[model samples]
Target chain A: MSAEEWEKVLWKTQSYPDNHIPARYFLASLRKNPNFRPYTYWPLVLASCAITQHLATIYIFLAVFVRLKECSLDPRILVWITVACFIGGYLAWELLNCSRSDTARRNANGTKTLKSSILVFLALMALSPVLKTLTAATSSDSIWALSAFLFMLNALLADYSPAKLGGQVRERLTSVLSMNAAISSSVVLGSRLSDGLAVFALILFSVQAFALFPMLRQRLQATLTIFQALLTLLLSLLSICLTASLSATVSCIYAATLVAVTFVAPGILVWAQKYKNEIRGPWDVAVPKVN
Target chain B: MDPLSIAMITDFFHPNVGGVENHIFMLSANLLRKGHKVIVITHSHDPDRVGIRWMLPSLKVYYLPYPTIASSATLPNYFTFLPYFRTIILREHITLIHAHASLSPLGQEGILHAHLMGVRTVFTDHSLFGFEDAASILTNKLLEAALKNVDAVICVSHIGRENTVLRGQLFEKTDEDPSTVAVSGNVFVIPNALVADQFKPSQIPDVSQPSSKPLCVTIVVISRLAYRKGIDLLVAAAPRICSAFPNVKFVIGGTGPKLNELLQMREKHLLQDRIELLGPVRHSDVRDVLVRGSIFLNTSLTESFGIAILEAACAGLYVVSTRVGGVPEILPEDMISFANPEEDDVFRAMSEAITIVSQGKHDPWNAHKRVKGFYDWFQVAERTEKVYESVIKSDQRDLWTRIRRTMELGPFAGLIYVVILIVNCVFFLILEWSIPREDLHFVWMHWNRDYFIELSQKEARKTSFI
Candidate 1:
């Protein structure tokens, strides 16, 4: 619209010609749709791997639980298997941590401390009996309800990504909800068992799977090559298979799920995200200084 | 021509007080006065005023119950809001969707649905965002996506426009036809408007005259005590400024997470004698606070319009503010003193403003006239109405006359989306075929949407509009 046209009608129609485009005007100056970057294959795949690995680990843990429940597997044998895997994973992680001379780049700082782990172990040990008998007085239904609530809390609170990672806190919190439920379920089951040794074994497994494994997974991502990751995944799958032999149907189901999880889940998630294509515009509030 | 019907979209609105909320209220009220049909779409906070409640004659507000994950922003449940938003538009016959604030999920969701429904989308940026930081980057990306098909962007100042263009990466490498994604010229600079009549300075006789003792000058620092507000600078400068000038006393107001820090400073400096912490005075009482002071101190790191400064100016207080964001453009040099967002600079500026008042360089009468001349809701309403017309006309020129008119559409909207979707699907299919869903364990949904909806809806409909 022309200056005359705009001026003539602060409220009424003007004398300016129709189709009189204002040159270099504010609206015209805006690039209608801008700054959209297409996602490449490799980065998308890498991002998916974070989800993939998490699902695979969850499956492996479920497979272990199934084996323990059905096969009547020797507690000593399962403990040994878990210890060997932990030691190997630890060695691999330490080497990776050492190789990355730039400590700043490495995410595995202060987190993998033996002291912290020991302290956590002591704390958990101290709390387990209290945790076991503490809720015993409550009705079974309420206990169930409370356990479910605690699991949800754990899921909400768990940080999947370190501060350096790209995912939002909310996203990571979502990822851990399943893990929280599984661990809490195991704890409830452990308390139900008559054997204290069985309870201890289950508790140790829960700690490894929930608390310790996520940190290891992050380190593995940071430190390992594709070949090494594949190799580790293969080994983890083998252990899952061995563990599965102890429990037939449930373990078989879990093992199959692990394969599907490692391959399909990430790809599906990426696909969904790509299709949705979140469009953000100026309507969003500007993050202001609190000052 | 008839006044345009506008759907003002914001996450925050009346009952919730903030810059964006106040902006929407004032803008809508003024637009309504100009005979425009203005309805607001925001998430419900109050109960009784939930869903559709008429705020004024010809001004209706539709409150949507979207889950707020943090602060007041909806969870960006994009497609979830489309149906209701569409219904609201159809019923109200909303010609334009004018969204305020760039980081709000509800605002972005409104724009997306508005675009899908073939309505004109105009976004107003109320604050500046930096290029750096993860949160800002994500926000910028979301803003970029939202702006992809928007008609035009309204910035409060030239600086805000520049920041938006740069941070949004609106300009990048051009296509073969030299077609850019978007141009910077689409940014309209419309400064904030104030109800000038409401801010008319009270004629208190003997207020500005020389007293028996040296004139007691009050420096007002009224804002949330937060890092962004540069409250630390105020906390640091309060003691020095007060100690340097015994005649001057500090009246600091507003509260935030940094209130404890301010209190600590007050306690440490023994400033109970010199400084007064008013502790979060109401918006209605802002003028009462301002009129008590000779100089208004705004030690902010960033500001969109510095509406508080404008309000202070309207109250005839000399604005001593940091020259950051849109603040530098708000007032002329004589009526205000520009300071860097630092303790030394703020202190210096405060001293300078005091000196200028002492020397009678700035007449209170002249300051009032300048303020009245600069900002008024009527003028703002007119300019905003012009924006509405121009934006509507622009949309008429750009929007497809037919649903499948590819000629008017660009690559980003049509072909690229199809290709990207196909490619992603192909990859997903391959993964699925190679892998298996039966083998994959499904994770249950975390939060119950239905439960939250019922609760929020009940709260929205039940609460009184206080």
Candidate 2:
């Protein structure tokens, strides 16, 4: 094609067909992978730790339930252990907050947190007897099926992202649904237990697992990187050991999931980057410059 | 050459006032004047009227009784429209199926069904969609599916062509070999046109006449008050513009959900006297509104083609538009004052345009002549006719090539498309068996020979200089 013929001016009529694509100008404006930000192995692995922590929490919850069912651990002892862990987590969170420069801006509200925690404990204690008999009339088969479905809902709906982008109503809804499902699952499981004390210990452990634990873990992960990775490893080991004490098959599945989530998924993502071809050009809708 | 019968399918048509609707109406009318039998298929707009209605002597519209989804788009039922669409195709003897607007499900489905029936298809994209959002992703995937086997794809601007190719995933990427990055083979850049005669400057007040008293420069904005139109920028820039040029006034037209926010902004700035919000002017009154202003301001954050700017220019008004999408490609540098889609930039550009117009530095008459010569519906129809001719002349793809192209979309999408095509074939058989070809009568129509003779004479005059 002649140099003069290659111009894309619209004012003058040309002999070529309107859909005639000249080879020189064909894909001339295409820009491949314009917004591709390179991903490293470590950051992706760190992000995947959120999934690992969630799965580990689920495994630990199931393990505690099984142990309670077998009466392998005392209900009072289990309650004491959960209380000690909650207080320790609170102190560690406060220490982390004190070390941070934004503590004043955050307005650490220790008294409010304490008050809410005490209120929750008292409420759970009062509700245990009711929860124990709540699903007694329902058959064991239906109880197991309902609890299983709720647990699945919790797992599917949990927010696993590291950064909490503010005010996404859909994300907030999913997170709320996940919490509600987990709490409902715990309530149903508590009703399955014969002892009211066992029900209380199970509810308290669930409150720690579903509600306070995620906030503490998120804080730790945001502030201390090494501590977050170490905590992930520690939780994985604990979940595996606990699951093994119950069933070998469950422990094996947990180990396989841990390896797959922590190592295989990130590897797949990094590998798939090779096939990423997002074309951007002058034709794209320009991002408006905000004042 | 024998004139081709054409079917224009879209959900947007008359009763809906927008750029795409006007483009379709004008193009179809021009095609009819050129002696081609034209029929438009769109969803029913009013309950009182639904079947075949003739808008012009040669132009007919078939409003399919289908439920509308969001924003006047029909609900996407992949195979539901095939029987009726095929009947229209057969009855009208339509050789070409021209689908408008990527977002319109009726248009996309028309293209797909036309292709399945072995009829040539052309798709025209009118808007720009980004790839980052989920909605765009889904829409793009659907576009990819529809355009995979289409004979030709037409975009309204060069940038629009690029966007269509990208969304359709019609390019290949290779670092080692630039030649391997196969460009979209059939994508075309055909800029949208306006009815230049209708937008003549003589319809309203002339911008060139200097007043004895200090005259307030009227800056007109006519668009749907939507977020994508950059109404927020207009809201932010209006007060600053009013303050910067004390003799400047604003006349805004069109209505949308964002009109309340603009009203609130106007009240907060206390410039109700300076700003006149004339909500939703009819399409016929657009030129009347445009000639009342010395300058036209468009604050659209994204646009495929700024047809409003062209109409404003045709009305002999200087244009100030955001330098996003295909807005920059529509007018010459002298006729337009370009700004980034920012409030401050819009305010600055508006102030600059006001100064330029007040100083009599730009000639509105020359701008009007330039726009009139640049965009004409007859020219658009002729170009579209060429596309149709080329598509009809091209060799038909065998079944395997069609299936392979459809399967290239992705595993799941490929599965869905394959199933759709299979069902489409079965449905085609069912249609053929139930509704025998002899039973469907061809709608006999004739065109005014004098009209074609006049159009041919005009065409000859247009090409005489070339």
What TM-score does structure 2 among the candidates reach?
A: 0.89
Native contacts retained per candidate? Answer: 0.00, 0.46
Clashes of 1: 36
Expressed as tens digits, the lDDT of each residue in B190-218 for candidate 1 is 77777766665655535556342327888
Each prediction's whole-model lDDT (CA): 0.66, 0.84
TM-score of chain A of each: 0.62, 0.89
For this target, which candidate reaches the highest TM-score against the unseen true structure? 2
Model 2 lDDT tens row, B1-466? 4788889999999878788998899888888878887889999976655888878545788998998878899889888998899898988888889999999999999877886566889999998888877898899899999988888888998778877887897764456787677665577778888877788775344556644232678999999998888888888888888887889999999999899998998899898998999998998899889888889999888888888888898888889999887777777688899998787788788888888888867666677778888887888888888788878889877767878888989999998997887788889889999998899987775556687689989999999978
Residues A74-171 of candidate 2: C-alpha lDDT, one tens digit per residue: 99999999999999998887786675446554565776787899999999999899999998899989988998899889888888765432322243
How good is the docking of model 1, as DockQ?
Answer: 0.02
Question: Which pairs of residues have clashing backbones in candidate 2?
Answer: none
Tell me, by DockQ, which candidate is best.
2
Point out where model 1 deviates above 4 Å: A1-291, B171-184, B205-214, B395-466
